[model samples]
Target: MPQPPIPVAVLTGFLGAGKTTLLNFLLKDPFLADAAVIINEFGDVGIDHLLVERSDENVVEMASGCLCCTIRGDLIDTMHDLLARRGRGEIKAFNRIIIETTGLADPAPVLHAVMSDPGLLATCRLEGVITVVDAFNGMATLDAHAEAVKQVAVADRIVLTKVDLLEGREGEDMLFAIIARLRKLNPAARLLTTHRNEATAERLFTMGLFDPTKKTPDVQNWLAAEAYATGEKRGRRHAHHGHHHHDHHHDVSRHDEHIRSFSFTEANAISPQGLELFLELLRSYHGANMLRMKGIVKLADDPSSPVVLHGVQHVFHPPVRLAAWPDADHRTRLVFIVKDIEKPMIEGLFKAFTDQISGGADAFTDTTLSLNR
Candidate 1:
């Protein structure tokens, strides 16, 4: 028997970019009827899943702080489990997978995972990456959030949403400037506009990586188009990498914590239980301060395919699996942008998540190893 094909598409943009709204519209269509939806939110209270109306069996939402940062391992695991169930006749065959990133997320790492994983690449094809931009506050967000800028820069398709909500001359010009900036960031991406997110599923799916005629996304070309290609030309520049360069006193007075970001990656595959525990720990510590976390995770049990995770303040979306590997190298990569969290702390916690700490290392020792259901 032939293996079922899986098409993965990422929906990403800055906070309040109407990503959820667009998703709501997309999922309601008949075309998306059987697609498995994964929502990664970064908040203590995961309400987005509640907001999204879908067939319960087909949707999974991660309630951890950020899916991309904390639950990428979980994402891959979930996808594998989904496939196993499909093999067992547990659920209807899902031909497509849609991953929605947290608003304040950078899509590069997610794309890297999908385009680089080996197991995922064989069974699944990358359809395309769709970025939704809020016509109302997009310009201001682009200037403020580095993640938003990267989201626009790496999109295969840019969808302008909520244009009808904009009012007055300032709003109109802001919309135009937002589009102009997008053109500079990504010249080849197909552009689409939605006044109220009134777009057909066919139009949204057009940018997918798997052209029925051309089976796979050219891995080399896709990675090259993004910043990772010109890693040298881009420089070792991070939005929050140079904390020492900023005037701490002035920044505090001005409440510059609003503009914050961080990135981290690990060399080993994380245990599914370890990933969940790490997310719980993050929520217990930095839930309110976390803005976004997105990453690709390699699971110790399943190295062939990497899982994709996304999150927004306190709310985690679900993790999605790619069919086969995108490339040969397999390292768990995650990028996080937090409001006021320190980089060292983030790194320390990540290590703690994957490290084999002694059971007696802490006062409370309850790491039985369970995952997000």
Candidate 2:
């Protein structure tokens, strides 16, 4: 019998951000007693896995160059082996999985593997991304490292470590400053302030509907359509991130440093044909610019039902139409995190497709999307 897809949550943070510490803490929980852990350390000497206290059998370590680069093929093979063993009942049955990426690694490549691999996609589904930030070093790291910025921008949740080190009113003020910067960078991710070893697995794995315990994921939580909506009103850019890049020269890798995230909402229903054409055009022309695209859309074919959309780069998961809207708000909303995409270009594409809106919408800033061919 085919099993239900298992949810896999990623644990990523900049170096010295307490990612391993958090993992060590979560593993202590009775809730994660059945969880399978895959640790990827980006060094020749992969000792992080050894430091983690686990029963040996369920924990996996990939200590090669990095999951983002050299060891990708091995990572996929490892997934297959784990699934095969689980099916044979050769190991304990884990209800979920947690993948810990090295501090220096970019998560996009791992995410792309999960999204694009048909074999893995069949058995596993992405629950969410949990990024740990070194409270003491996060600001400096972000300023100095592109990987750190991308880590924060792409996460569903952000966890800060070493808050215990900051002291007095000075510490309080500095903490606020760090959080302010974080919100500006990725407004959608939930920011939590907890002492080390205190966050339960429950709080960390809240990746929308994928939880299964809940009938439907809080759509607002995953998409944060309102945050992007606010950014548009105030004038801002798009931000979103993981996974190993399939190709360095591919358009997706070109402008990763300047990635931004924002969203759009349409009151009028969009024609299905128009939506399809718009997406195709966006993927064909500016797919490289798009890091992640997610939305709850009101389609002309099914005005009462809203469609769910999610994609990385040019690859999109099949659209899912809900029986009814989760709330009274029946408007169409799309949240985008892209490297160099502009709101005007997407708005123009939508306008060209359907009579959804009569006029083009405004962008926080103007950008010309060079549509070659």
Candidate 3:
């Protein structure tokens, strides 16, 4: 019998965000005893790898039975070597894999590598992205670095570290501002504060398509479409007023303004061809700006069985069709996290393709093809 695919979770954050500390905490938990860790550093000497307590040289066995290794070459090659070694009885078989990326790295490439690699995909599936944010410095980092904003934008869970350092009224005010900014950047992600003892291993991992504890499809928690929908309305209202009143305190170089998170629902079922064309247009035209896109699509041929679509930039995983609808909300819902791409453009493109498939006039003419930002 074939073994089930292991879930791979990517842990990322900005510089000094305490990701290593969080990892140490998680490794101490009994639930992650069978987990394997791959640490990626951007220098000649791997400091993070040394920080992790280990027993051996190459594949260090953690005190908790978790295996840890530092990436010396290509990520794909390293993963393949690990799998081969495990097969040859060189290492213990780990049920979970956690990749800790360097602070300055853009997680999109990491995600692309895991999602696009055929070999890795066959044996492993993406669990989710967990991002660590420094409560004291997160706002400043996000204002200056586009990479930090992307980290939070693509996260399934946002862990705010260093909250214990914040004291007095001034610190309280800073924490409030940072939390508000984080929520605006990515409304779908679950936010947790370290000071409150909320960032636990059990709560952080296993954030995939299915809830292992419930043994059911957790579409609502995964998608959080309602949160994005609410954010979209607020954005429109802010835009209609001519200026963002809440953004007056921000600097001109703030990258958060470029990021947008929104969601839309299609009441009618979409044909397969229409869906294909729509996705193709988005990927071909604006894939670079698209940070992430995920949705449960309702097909015209089989409305009862919805298909889940997930993509990072131009690379998309194979659409998986669920056996049945996860909830009564049968409408096709999609959530998008993009930079410099507005919600109207996506909505218009989708409508045009679906309408054309429904026997309407060709909507792919130059006039409709014209894209603004």
Residue-level lDDT tens digits of model 2 in 1-373: 7666788888898988988777766666667766777776434443344333333443442222111112344677767777777788766577787778888988777777676788887888788889999887777788778788878878888998889888998788668757856776677888875585446678888665456566665677788877766655433333222123111121333233476678877787878876787788778887766777888888898899888887777877667788889877888878887776677677656654445444333311121233442
lDDT of 1 at 366: 30
By lDDT, who's the top model here? 3
Q: What are the models' TM-scores?
A: 0.51, 0.79, 0.91
lDDT of 3 at 28: 80
Of 1 and 2, the candidate ahead on TM-score is 2
lDDT of 3 at 70: 75
Off by over 4 Å in 2: 1-3, 41-73, 168-170, 196-198, 231-257, 356-373
Candidate 2 residue 178 C-alpha distance from true site, Å: 1.4
TM-score: model 3 vs. ground truth: 0.91
**Per-model lDDT:** 0.60, 0.70, 0.83
lDDT of 1 at 115: 53
User: Residue 203, candidate 3: how far off, in angstroms?
Assistant: 0.8
lDDT of 1: 0.60
TM-score computed on alpha carbons, candidate 1: 0.51
Q: How close is candidate 2 to the true structure, as a TM-score?
A: 0.79
List ranges where model 1 is wrong by over 4 Å: 1-4, 41-73, 196-198, 213-373
